[model samples]
Target: SRAEQSRAEQSRAEQSRAEQSRAEQSRAEQSRAEQYLSKTNAQCLKGIFAIAVLCHHMYQYSGLFRGKFGIILQALGYLSVGIFFFFTGYGLIVSYQEKKEFYIKNFLRKRVLPFYLFYLFLTAIYALWRIVLNIEYTRRQLIQSIIFKDALAANSWYLQVIIVFYIFFWITAKVVKDTKKLVRMIIICSMLYCVGCFMLDVTSTRYESFLCIALGTMWAVNKKRVDKLLDIKGLQLFLLSIILFGVFCSTYIIVDNLAIQIFSKMASALAFSSMAIIFVFKLSGRAEVLINNPVTQWLGKYSLEIYVIQGIFLLLRKGTKLYIQNPYVFIVVCVIGTLLLAIVIKSVYDWIVRKCRPQVVNM
Candidate 1:
């Protein structure tokens, strides 16, 4: 009887261990599944999109890669920006969710001030460059450039949009206590902003990607529910997202009215962003090796610097001997030059931060 009881106890122990092992394995799988848009992955995506933006600007400046290639690059440029906005919205929402008080307390200093300072610095540099080059501009034009009414730098509209979004986010966070209400307000305000931009007859560039930000916010807010609803196999989910993306893109192409096309473009951007997230999540291992490699991570770390500095080069190279005649050569030079300039800017920025830290602490 004693031997039989001991054997039964051992069987129970083995069963318990098996169940624990299965539970742990399930948790590991869940964790991997949720790693779709981790911060690192997001940064890698930013790095990739940053280069896409660069290529788009290059094509705009040089008119290289004619026909379909050029068109595709141009399209990617717009989509790249939508991805950035999506990340911004998602990041802000997740940050607020994780540490409400901390995020709110340092919202301006941590979130807004750096953007303002960098933008101000870039604007000043643009102004100085124009003055040094003796570029003709009326006082009104100069003022407008400074205020972001006109582009002083290549693709400066993005800075204006992001700054506005940051301010809007800060204000909305302060005013709305309920998360659901807050998300609704954000979406409504984003749409209204788009409408205002359209009414002002601003370049389509200014408003087209804005809805992606609201979409990002919505995804972040309802991620759990959405994830649950779409909890099919990874391949199936990926295919579904691709189908959605294709549908939206087709709608964008087929739409007759410019207004409808704009809306469709925004929808397509949202679909693309979703597809990208799914792709990365499903293929995270491969993505880590290929997309999220050291080079991309480094690029992502200095993406903002690269973005701001490349515009200066664009200005400098235009109508000057500095401009490379060969498109291929120009791209090589531009990429290398932008990376070098970005590095220098980052070094200087870091040095300034290091110099200021002690004083800040003392104060």
Candidate 2:
């Protein structure tokens, strides 16, 4: 009888263990689902920002579209950077919400590595092609691009800016634990930073303000809010806001005095911020369908790859003089070509990473 009782007790213990394991598995699955959702939004926002930059560039190099339209498009160009910084801040802060210590390393490991690798690969390809074409090339230019310095004035000034913001944000999020205080400091400093940039006509300093504003805004928004922003049924509000912002900026840009330049610039920046707010709100809300949509979402995922590889298209244009006269055609070709290359390169990179992932995991 005692022996029978022991067997029954052992069976019950095993059943309890199985039940606990199932519960834990369920919780983990839920956690993964949430993370996938978060990453989808981040990718969506980044993809849009990348495309915006591309569009702004198209408008820019197309000499046919000049004057007021030109100025508005040019202003819109910088907003891409603004959107990028905001997403970075939001993504990094939210990522570190649970455990902040590993944020910097993880940022470098996942985001920076892919970027640098792709940059180096494409840069080398461009340099070789340029050499074959007998174009003037320098080791200094290569080094400058690698270090994210102001050496060549390549179209990738934004990449350097991204690296800067990543470091700045990582350090700040690490040191300043108080959320409210950090937000206040970021805002105050961003304003002062903008003032200094405007006074000096310092483009880099202006970019720094974008970083602070983005991170500050991200720190302000939460997960529940993010979901609502992603729901795309409310997209009209976002589109309308963007249009109004554009109009306001165009008006400001046409007024050509020094004081007005400063004010207009400020107005333009504010418009960008306003647009960003609406974008994030809608992105995090019901309008997320646009972002969560399969094609846009996939493009969003690999947008960084597109950013890095797009330079190859620029190099091709410079080398072949293709679509040089027709600005719109040039941009269209460049965009299409860059996207194709990005896909190819990203596929190879992902395969290699997956193959070597065990080593990475061990490390």
Candidate 3:
């Protein structure tokens, strides 16, 4: 009887402790969801990936990487872009869902205008450089470059592609009253484009990139369900495999003979980006120190400026041979030079944002 009573007490105590632990875990999960819903870790992730892209560009010209190292660098650059494209879609919808009022004009004024201003600023800087050096760029050419957005930047199509996605998102969000349907529409559209790519010889990176974005938005839009799904051990492993497969797909050249060629399977890119976002969402708390470090925080804070500024400098590197010959020297010069310019550009951007629309600075 004494032994039985002791075991009974032990069971009750264990059950009570388990319940409390479950409650604490639930609270922690909710807190984490809120953080992922916000832009802090988003910025940190952006900063980290943008730096990867920056190095990819620098190495492209530096004669630094050869063989598999080169492939890895290329994959880093491309996959980083894939991650970015997904977040752009995910973040947009996440913000939109949080809003009481979805004002297109206000969104454009706040988000699109700042980007356009930065692009113009970059164009103006390039134009001034050409004029000062008497390198002979036509005004028409400059205007076209600014309008078309591929004249000088290392990865020129990114902004243009994203803007199109933004516009399409707004239009579709208006039509689809339900978030689920909106996500479905995007998936259908992506599938159609992929079909064209494989069957019609129409390979448009924009469509595929939009697919990645769509998947991201889908993840965010279906946050509650997906979060629960992510808790499943089997599902997590499956998603992880999908991500790896996607990375493998993104690495191979699609056009080569003996290549799998189904566009190196953009599906891989889509899966990898989607899983990566979920992974980051899950790990945001653990990486907070690196995420919130002063330099990294600054980098994360001003990632867009860094992205745009580095592209401009890399373009100059190509034209002016501003790059150093020695690998170490080149890396130091590029990394420091890019960061410094990015910092300066960010300050200028802040000033402009304050002067033009002080209200939007925080928004």
How do the predictions measure up, each by TM-score? 0.86, 0.68, 0.80
Candidate 3 structure quality by residue, lDDT tens digits, 1-363: 999999999999999999999999888876875576457667777888889889888778777788878977865666677778778878877777777255543666566666666667777786665554445667677767787634544354677666656666677777776767877887787677557655665444444445677777787888778766655553565577576765657555544642254445455666667666666656655665655567666778877777777755554444443434466776777778788888888888886666555263464
Query: lDDT ranking from best to worst?
Result: 1, 3, 2
* Candidate topping lDDT: 1
lDDT tens digits, residues 95-149, model 2? 6665556655465556666555655665677677666545576788788767875
Candidate 1 vs candidate 2, lDDT winner: 1
Clashing residue pairs in candidate 3 are: 246-268
Error of 3 at 121 (Å): 1.1
**What C-alpha lDDT values do all the predictions have?**
0.78, 0.61, 0.68
The model with the greater TM-score, 1 or 3, is: 1
Which of candidates 1 and 3 is the stronger one according to lDDT?
1
Lowest summed lDDT across 10 adjacent residues in model 1 is found at 352-361
Q: Report the Cα lDDT for candidate 2.
A: 0.61
Q: Write the per-residue lDDT of candidate 1 for residues 1-363, one digit (tens) a residue.
A: 999999999999999999999999878767766776788878888988888888888888776788978778888877888888899888888888888766877777666666666676677777777666666567786678667777676566788788878888888889897777888999999999888878888778888888889888888899887666555665787787788778877887777888878877777787778777767766654445676788889888887777778876665456443445777777777888899888888876565444433234454
- Give the clashing residue pairs of candidate 1, or none: none
